[model samples]
Target: MATISEQNASSISPVIRLHRSDDVVIARSQLVGGTVLQEEGVTVSGLVPPGHKIAVRAIGQGQPVRRYGQIIGFASRPIAPGEHVHTHNLAMGEFQRDYAFCADAKPTRVADGNATFDGIVRPDGRVATRNYIGILTSVNCSATVARAIADRFRRDIHPEALGAYPNIDGVVALTHGVGCAVDAEGEALEILQRTLGGYVVHPNFAAVLVIGLGCETNQIARLVEKQHLEALVSTGRLSTYNIQETGGTVKSIERGVELVQGLLAKANDARREPVPASHLVVGLQCGGSDGYSGISANPALGAAVDLLVAHGGTAILSETPEIYGAEHLLTRRALNAQVAEKLVARIRWWEDYCARNHASLDNNPSAGNKAGGLTTILEKSLGAVAKGGTTNLVDVYEYAQPVHAKGFVFMDTPGYDPISATGQVAGGANLICFTTGRGSAYGCAPTPSLKIATNEALWQRQQDDMDLNCGPILAGTKTIEEVGAELFQLMLQVASGQRSRSEIHGYGQNEFVPWQIGAIT
Candidate 1:
């Protein structure tokens, strides 16, 4: 894909052609009927919304439509040049994907020197971007009690609550709606336990508390045993209590408060020290995306990921469902056949999972995404994969599994934003870099989230929620590399304690959603 500047250099083009062979071009702005696309040598046949597609050439019914030099979908009907092409004319179709493993894998270009950040170093040599006391629940029944305990220490509600513990970020309670109805030996239980375990040992948390209902199937003891959290419990860094065992909700809340208070001093003992950028682990995500997502923010973020990997840091690209048709892109860049096969296996699993549920992978480009000019899953997937950057896929992981490999990697996760990001955080991402063109308001606790706007209009409309703007790339004022370098610096600053817009608004606490699988009964 040509940079926006290069595409618009001669004269400001009203539409953007991602590839010379693309059947459609994205409207740079609203183009009224009869408007002339001088460069494409076509006159607009009808009104086209900003960021929407306009056919660049004639296409026959059942013919594949290309974008980004890849097939996005097939033309459902004959499409005339200059005509608007969207769901009404474009549809999903089956096609063969060439999974030539390691075909494009290349050695990483290491940066000259390591970048540094002011980070909190744990006694065990782990690094943290923020310090907080986390309260986790094993079942829905203990949610209220956990919230009550965290409410008492709300800095916004009571400014003086943490007067003495300046180092502590804040107290947060991460609760879920399911736990009791799940099978004790099922995948759902295992996922929940793994997610909870990740939080207990997350470096951002100085200490953690687990609350549970004594009679629930998701027993606290089993969770501890399964996740191997006994070490944290033994060291007093993790504490667990049951509402039923504690006698009632009131007693549970009181005990929880007391436990948190006792840990404040120890949590406050954490002090910031200089740490290498190699310690940074970022989770890559994009939500409420639009046409400019691939054109601007996604690729720009990918560039930043390349820079991060060059510095020996790690970046995790997840949302397996969102990357449905794009898996082959990552597979070819895999470090070896084993890594490539792992990614392909996940894709196959999703295919069967969707088939069992009577669903299709094409059931994406949600209403919001369609409204933003995305037409099919293939189109969206092509854009989504751009956030991973051009790098060899070092490893692949199941949902919520710990990420031990450094450099760009993939994780199997659903398309839902909250659940997908939840898995990423559980996999040891200390920070999140999220790209959005439709202005999604999201955050992940324990791990700070940085929002990047994909277009100028969104940046202007949602400036308060956005941390950085890649809009300049869309406006032809900046290149992807330029914005990417800027984003990399911002990552270091945020990792060093500079609060993102979402953090300032306290958006993380309510966004904890673990991926739920298996039967409720």
Candidate 2:
């Protein structure tokens, strides 16, 4: 998407033109008929809502509607100057994008940030932002037992029990709707195993208790063997129990509580120490996006990402479907041909997957998205890709795969926000920065999530939910670099034990929705 330049414009301008070649400008605020736009020397013909576009020049029927210096859509009907440009006049159409493999790729000039945060140091020498005791349910059947066990400590049933060790964050049950009613083998099962394995070893959870039913297709023993969790069990960092094997729900919960108590003591012993920025892995996510997403928060997040990369940290950009039309931009930044090809392969798989399901890529931009001024998947994707910043694409991983390489990486995930974020966290993202315009309320446990508002109004309206405001970039109160710096500093503070708004409100426990693939039968 085009980055608007307001350097030369008056602060009171009613509309913002993103590029010199753009045919439309976004209404900075609601405009009534006959209102004058001094920059464009044009009069508003009719009412235009804030964030909606207005034609700066006459557009012929079937012509391209340009925004962010790229085609957002094709005009379905002739558009005159000052007419509002939206779904009523714009239409989705296919246009070829140049892949240009490795064309824009460049060497990373590693920047010395001299930044450090207080993070927990694990026995394996890995760094963590939080120390939690987790109960992982392998199937929906055991979810109740897992939650009941965690609920005991959560409600302070034995408040003095954990008084000796105060560093442990809390006991949390990571329950999902799946783990049963699916095939025993293939992609779906592999995804589940990988996701579970990732969590089992995640540094944030000092120890994990895996709970399962006696007879689900996803056997707990098989998962442990496949994920090679024998060492963890030996080290007392992991404990497993089956409900039926442990004498049903009541006994299982009791046994789980006893097991968790032992782990809590060990978890509480963990302490935060100064760690370099390289230890951080941040997941980039955007939901409930609006026109200002590209203009403000997304780009500001991108700028922060660039800074993170310079400091040798890892940043993950996911939601494959959401990145559909803009994959070309990322491919150009791929570190090598192999990296670019892996990204392309995923794109092809998605296209075929959509076709097999009798759907199209353009079937995105949900009701809220359209209402917020995003017209098509192309336009949405263009804005979404800005969150990655201008960094070399280092590697690509399957959903829930461990991320070993640093810098910018891509994880294959669904566009659904919770599912996408679930995969990122499972992949070892210790932190998340989720941007929104229409206001998406989301959070993830273990890893703290920082919610960024794309506009001033959204930030004010969702004061309790939002963590930072990127709206100043749109309002001319601050530059993108300034906001990016602010965000980067906030990340370090949060990494050092500063609770984010989401963490403060306990918004992450119920948002753990894993992506379910394959057949139910």
Candidate with maximal lDDT: 1
- Over 199-250, each residue of candidate 1 has an lDDT whose tens digit, in order, gives 8888999999999989999889988999998899999999998998899988
Give the local distance difference test score of model 1. 0.91
- Model 2, range 186-295, lDDT digits (tens) per residue? 77888988898998899899999999998998899999999999999998889998998999889999999899877776678787889998899999999999988888
- TM-score: model 2 vs. ground truth: 0.98
Off by over 4 Å in 1: 1-11
Which portions of model 2 miss their true places by more than 4 Å? 5-10, 155-161
| Per-structure clash totals for the candidates | 0, 1
Clashing pairs in model 1, backbone N/Cα/C closer than 3 A: none
Model 1 residue 458 distance off true place after TM-score fit, in angstroms = 1.0
Q: Residue 53 of model 1: what lDDT?
A: 91
Worst 10 residues of 1 by lDDT: 2-11
**Per-prediction TM-score to the true structure, in the order listed:** 0.98, 0.98
